[model samples]
Target: MTAITKGAPRAFVLLRSRRRLDLLDPDPEAWTDEDLAGGLSRTMRWGGASQWEHPLSVAQHSLTVLAIREADGALTAGEGLRELLHDATEFMLGWDCITPLKAQLGEPFRALEARLQTAIDARYRLPRWTPEDYALHKRADRLAAASEAMHVVGWSRVEMRKTLGIAETPLVHDPLSPCAFAPWEPWPPRVAERLFLERFHALDHAHRSELRKLEPELRSSLVLTGAEHAAS
Candidate 1:
């Protein structure tokens, strides 16, 4: 590990991969993909509340969002990767605070999360979200939250709208049901970790393939720009 500058703030956590992450100043390469998958699988959503055998995990929630987006239409590899990692920072922080709670945590907490998210984005080379894309992502995220609240967290439709402040109707059919797990059932940590890693690797492969396909065009564009510069 690189030496921390004297007097600089540091909060370190040992990862499952036997790597240390400095939470105050995170190094994107310090944690492996497996570390992220394991952390996410253990990070509970809905403040760890559950109506079933286990609390819903951020890993499962991420897959749910990706599935929802896939159900909408075919997605580019980048889009799929974005959906899969939208909340990845929560895994590193070891907390998935509810929206209302996040507000209460104030700007300092938000800044910390933002720093961590920046690191995650760098690590994954995630695409930036356009306004329309961000709106779509939020819609899917809310839909997943609504469905999980109703089926997994035991919130009624009325309560979802009133108490949870979710206006979207919960999805009747779980998007991930096709995976052979019970509908809306939260998988155990080990199962969630395995599934999350599988999806991540698949998406990563496709994303890299797409990037490779674009490389020749990118080189041509760069060469054209250089010629134009010389002619000017």
Candidate 2:
């Protein structure tokens, strides 16, 4: 990885030589889909899960986000492209959970990640760190995170009060189903991949119209989520 200060700014570049993802290599011109599958498949190991979630993969969570977004309306091919790259850097930087990273790793990983992301952008011909994309993706990512915390992880308003030390009601309007944590909740690895493609094909062009617009009231409900699930 190399950093060139050609412009008046000091941007980073970590993956100067890495290959762009090939999920759609055979048909790079195919229809769009929600955030990247591989990115979400990212594991919760290395302190990735919050206390409420059951070690759900980022890929799974991304699917949920895509599903919810599709339920709203149609998104464009470009919007789908944007969503897919939202977490693309995870392929290289790995999912560094928020608290641990801010308190421990700090700026170094972020610096490298910024570089890797640049390479991803250049390779994919997508927009770079523009303010609009930043805001849009952050909203979806955070909303997805919060939804996973409250819905999938099984955290409660009381638990949130006791542990996270927040008096807020949490993003969930209700509690998790008893079956939510069942082993059956998570799909088998291969099935998960197939499901991602399935949903992508299913939602084709249905979510394009609302690409850049999201309801503030709706996303406001999602909050960060996680938990340490003890394997039985």
Candidate 3:
């Protein structure tokens, strides 16, 4: 989606689905998983300010968070799925700001994001965020941020914790080492899109009973296509 600024010439985005999404006032019906995946595959996180050659996309970051939650082994199947989709809204809406900048943007920015998130949650039949889920999400998000900071952005642990408000004790563990937390390298845009969709399907299959409750059209639309799976 194009940025919604006061005098920007382009005010709407035309998705591959031929749906025109209004930047200032997005219509939920105009969105689709295909559109989201494509957009997020291109949207850069940290406003594209990472040390890596390719900027970390929100889709990649989201998959890492779900992986962290799954590795933690405390959340249920539904909770794990929720973790995978916590940033789905960011997929449709362009990723433009970080946590600290969010405060500067104030309530308007937050309210808009929340509105998009609510629509996404309803479409997927995702349960409302319970207090526990919120806390866990925060922890997982911070853990990912710290990992990205230390590894991708090349920040020290002390700088990450002190500046980014990351948790002191790491929550995400290294898959290879099993003794430390490390960041996954940012994938190229195409790889990131495929992996994001692959993870989405994997989580959906693991939690189908919970996810199938969504509207049939939504459920079908959300499923990864044969081509996507093949590519991933």
Number of the top lDDT candidate: 1
Clashes of each: 0, 23, 0
TM-score of 1: 0.94
| lDDT digits (tens) for residues 1-232 of candidate 1 | 8887998889988999999999889898999999999999999998899988889999999999999989888999889999999999988889898888889989999999989989988888788999999999999999999999999989898988888789998999877863657899999999999999999999999998998899999999999999999999
lDDT of 3 by residue, 138-227 (tens): 887888777777666777778777877675554345432212223456777887787777767766676776555656867566575755
Ranking by TM-score: 1, 3, 2
Write down the TM-score of every candidate.
0.94, 0.53, 0.75
In order, the Cα lDDT scores of the candidates are 0.92, 0.48, 0.72
Q: Candidate order by lDDT, highest to lowest?
A: 1, 3, 2
Off by over 4 Å in 2: 1-42, 45-54, 71-73, 94-96, 128-133, 161-184, 197-232
Q: Model 3: what TM-score?
A: 0.75
TM-score of 2: 0.53
Predicted model with the maximum TM-score: 1
